[model samples]
Target: MASRRHGDYWQHVLDLVFLIGVTFKAIDGLGEILIGIPLLFITPAGVTNAVHHLTARELAEDPHDLIANLLVHGVNHLAGSDLRLLGIYFLVHGIVKAAIVIAIIIGAIRVYPWAIGALTALTIFQIVELALHPTISVALLTVLDIIIIALTWREWREHRSLRDTARETWRWLRPAPARS
Candidate 1:
């Protein structure tokens, strides 16, 4: 009985760990979305300001027929007209990421194989994106993501195998009922 209790405890711990991983992934997705939303507004302004300052410096050196050159490219790229569209795009992206996380969590809880498979595919995409991105912060984050993926994959495989083995053993252990 004590062994059975211990087994149950370990199983619960495994489940908790899986759930926590899913929760963490979801939180991470939400955080990225929130951060990206502000970036759409602030980035253009900041870039424009910086470019204006640089152009002013260049003009101070030689105010030749170059006023046209002062057209800040960053501001041009992030024109206010596009702000709403960009925000919507980012918002949708974030929502999708968050949704995937939630789906994975639900699937994990229910032991749904498809959920696990989908999560695995999403994890791979994340890794690939992180790898391709040039930012130093993102590179570090990519490393972290790879580690998490590796660990989660290992845990998932182990848990799945253990469950399968246990089920088979249970089947074998059940005695055949005596025919009257």
Candidate 2:
């Protein structure tokens, strides 16, 4: 009985952790969409003004400002005709990320195995990207991903143990048929 209680406690903790992770991803996805929309529609002058104020550098000199340069160039070369198309592109990217977040949340709530697989794939992708980038920030993010993966695996194992215990208890409690 004590073991059963322990199992239940661990399962609850796992559920909480999964919930928190999904919530965080959803919030991050929403933020991406929100930020992307405004950036996509920024006029050439607006882009230059924004970048000048933010970084105070020529966009060509900074690879980090590539997105800003693209926006400014697109607006200048294509006029306002391209703005709507760019906006649509950003909106689609945002929607896809947001949809992934929603799927993760739903999968976690349902305790579906696919959720774990999805998270594992995401972690692997991040690690590979970090390796290729080889930057201090990316390295730190990779470390963070490792910790998250460990916690997620632990939670999954605890949930499995709790399910096994419950199944065993149910089997034991089943009444035997009367002998003829």
Candidate 3:
């Protein structure tokens, strides 16, 4: 009984983790969509100017505000082509994440493996990005991605086991054909 209770506790914890991870991904996807759609319409200079304007008050209040300065510098360095490419990348990534989240939420067990594969690929991309340019935020995101991947793998395995058990039970309970 103690062991069973422990197992239940772990399962509950894992379920909560999965929920949090999925919610975070959903919010991230929505944010990417919001930003990417605008980038598709705005020119590089326009985006830069917009960033500058958006940060102007903060910059004025605190000249050394790291976030505002970083945004300004990053936007200034982007070319039209780079902006367009980035916009498309974000849009596609967000769409894929949204689809994966939907499938997972709908309990599409068959999609679990594909979702794991997709998430693993995305996590690898995050790892590569961290290797190229090590930022604290990116590092944190990478860590979160790793955690999410582990949780997703656990969920997939548990789901598969449950599905297999159900099938086995169904097979056992089915009436056998009468012998000819």
Candidate 4:
């Protein structure tokens, strides 16, 4: 009994955490859509000096911080369009994730199967993106998506079971038809 209650509690907690995560992505998407892509993008040539300077500072602060140093160098090496492309991805990804989050929150039973499909699509995209870029953050996000997929499947199963039980109970409680 205690384990059951604990499981229920953890399930709720996971749900809340997933919602918060997706909400942040939604906001991040909005940010990229509205401002990051439009205003902050710079050509590699335009930011060359700044990138070198920043990278140098990062290395000076902590010589062991290779990832930070590497990212600065990497962005400067990338084409200007890469930033814009990433921004576009974030914008679209954000919108889709938010819509799915809303559907899940509303307990739309039909949405579960569709949500799994949608998530699978997103995961594939993320994997492609990861292959292209290979950043730690991108890798972490892909892992998070996998976790959400599992949680969503669990929720979907529970929803179906609950509906089935309700139907059975209703049938048992309903009055029998009178003789013709």
Please give, for residues 20-126, the per-residue lDDT of candidate 3 as tens digits.
78889889888888878877878988988899999999999999999999999999898889888889978987887888888877768778788778878877887
**TM-score, cand. 2 vs. native:** 0.44
Two-way lDDT contest, 2 vs 4, winner: 4
Question: For each candidate, what TM-score against the reference?
Answer: 0.41, 0.44, 0.81, 0.60
After superposition, the stretches of candidate 3 with alpha carbons farther than 4 Å from their true spots are 1-7, 160-180
Cα shift from native, residue 126, model 1 (Å):
6.5
- Best by TM-score, which number? 3
lDDT of 2 at 18: 48
Superposition error at 87 for model 3 (Å): 0.7
Candidate 4: worst-modelled 10 consecutive residues by lDDT: 1-10
The numbered model that scores best in lDDT is: 3
Residue 18 lDDT (model 4): 53
- Alpha-carbon local distance difference test for all models: 0.56, 0.55, 0.76, 0.64
Inter-residue clash pairs, candidate 4: none
TM-score, predicted candidate 3 vs. hidden true structure: 0.81
Residues 1-180, model 4: lDDT tens digits: 011232354554655555555556556546645644542465666566666776787788898797767767676566667766765676676667767766755557678778778878988988998999787887998888788777667657666432333344344446778989
lDDT of 1 by residue, 34-136 (tens): 8568756665677577667778767677766255263654356776656656666556656765775565444453343444455456556656766685555
Runs of candidate 4 with Cα error greater than 4 angstroms are 1-36, 39-57, 131-133, 160-180
